[model samples]
Target: MAKKPKSDPNYKVIAENRRARHDYAIDEDLEVGIVLMGSEVKSLREGGANIAESYAAVEEGELWLVNGRIAPYAQAKTWGHEERRKRKLLASKRELARLWNATQRKGMTLVPLVLYFNHKGLAKMKIGIAKGKKHHDKRADAAKQDWNRQKARLLRDKG
Candidate 1:
């Protein structure tokens, strides 16, 4: 008989850059791997990480994650990991080239949208290839959101 695979545990998102969606017009997205030490991974498992201030940087043909803070593990040994070290993102050479070219345009950037663990328990980053939105665009988005909220409330009240 074939054995069934183990079910995946629920994902608990530690932190997210919600502002990314409102501030940028995300045109495309890609999943990328992150480099981390043992303690850093442990910290992430505990949901004590923040990517709000983080941004992806391309330098010397390599992609790096900057400003992402994974707090040091409390139980780690003396030689624990650095909290804000520049970690390399693992992506195919072709993908790297594509992102590099895309970022060359003014006001466009690669932003981390979300952080979560895969079914197999590996940490993953959802990155968006996006361009910055102007002030009016953000105001319009806020108004739209408010309208949606009011519509939902009215529908509930009618029921």
Candidate 2:
């Protein structure tokens, strides 16, 4: 995970699906707005959320985030939201159409990459259009990464 710069107080990462990149070959990603209740927002600000097992989908001509968990805020007893309810994602009509086409026609999956508050303090999520990686592909990628790491170490030692 990339560290958030200390200078930016508003930018905070609440959750990240780190395994998404290892399991899927991401083609592209987009930042989208999320609809959240007051309690949900408060919970997120406390950094209590999980996106590792969640994913995004385009259904009924709209985008939705499924399986994401936001822990309930303790103070808001009556207003607390469901921990694992489906949340609506906001995107332009054209982007929605493109995402639908990618999933239906191109055989791609919409994976939630990261969930965070942007610089403006609004909750946003980054979703990637990706295709599943086969076992052999994953192995090859791991081998390539290992080689790159060793090569960099050797170069540093030589210089």
Candidate 3:
């Protein structure tokens, strides 16, 4: 007999942009809904999504997710949605204004952190307002991580 998968009470993550943390200093994060076609949703359920190179932008008073890839559903045939399309993001007027204002600043950007399905089975995206990191900042972060790992090892040995 096959075993059933365990159910999680929280959201289920479909895709994540791990590089975003290394490339930017995130200031804040917000969860927003995404408009997706039926085929796209089916594909996502099958783990056919990528947000590593995707970003969100405010255009014409609305937020749009760009450069994200939701692979076509094999069963959909000719009716499959485009792999890379600019999908609309659902946000309130006040939230849109805030995102727009924040993006107007120099060195700030809207980056997609993760794509997931909420407990209600609705797709949502977690986006971050971030500032780009410099080369030195990345190096420093790497060194700090290395030192923390070494310190942990030393403590383990001593204990």
Candidate 4:
């Protein structure tokens, strides 16, 4: 039998932390399942999630996503989930151990890059192992991006 492709058309992105790339130098990334309540899932499907201030932490040999906000479902008045609850992330024991070890290094942290529903309709979080960028590093990166854009525009005009 032929192997199947990894990406499927059914997958849909719920929210992305675009600032993650600007604020941190991402080293590695992995997708992990997120534990969410029914109302939270519904809210996410309606495009209501904010991972801007969220980070992942390993505690008691398990990974947990912290500070992520999943807005309450509009129709879930009495049964709405908390907006900023810590959600558990599902990963293999080995993967969890590796992440824990990497986080032990100075200035290294786990940042949630994006939140999306998989092809199977299950909520997942793409977490990255990143180091926070310094003020100068951020400025340099912005300069490089500006230069790249300018170069692209110049080439397009010349062509």
lDDT of 3 by residue, 30-146 (tens): 989999999999999999999999999999999999999999899999888889999999999999999999999999999999899887889999899999999999999999999
lDDT accuracy of residue 104 in candidate 3: 98
Model 2: lowest-lDDT 10 consecutive positions = 1-10
Task: Decide which is better by lDDT, 2 or 3.
Answer: 2
Select the stronger candidate by lDDT from 2 and 4.
2
- When summed lDDT is taken over every stretch of 10 residues in candidate 4, the lowest stretch is 1-10
lDDT of 2 at 6: 80
Off by over 4 Å in 2: 1-6
RMSD of each: 5.1, 1.3, 4.5, 4.1
lDDT (tens digit, per residue) of candidate 2 on 27-134: 999999999999999999999999999999999999999999999999999777999999999999999999999998555999999999988999999999999999
Q: Candidate 3 versus the native: TM-score?
A: 0.92
Rank candidates by lDDT, best first.
2, 3, 4, 1
Cα error, candidate 2, residue 139 (Å): 0.2
lDDT tens string, model 1, 49-118?
9998899978999999998999989999796988888989888999999999999999889999888777
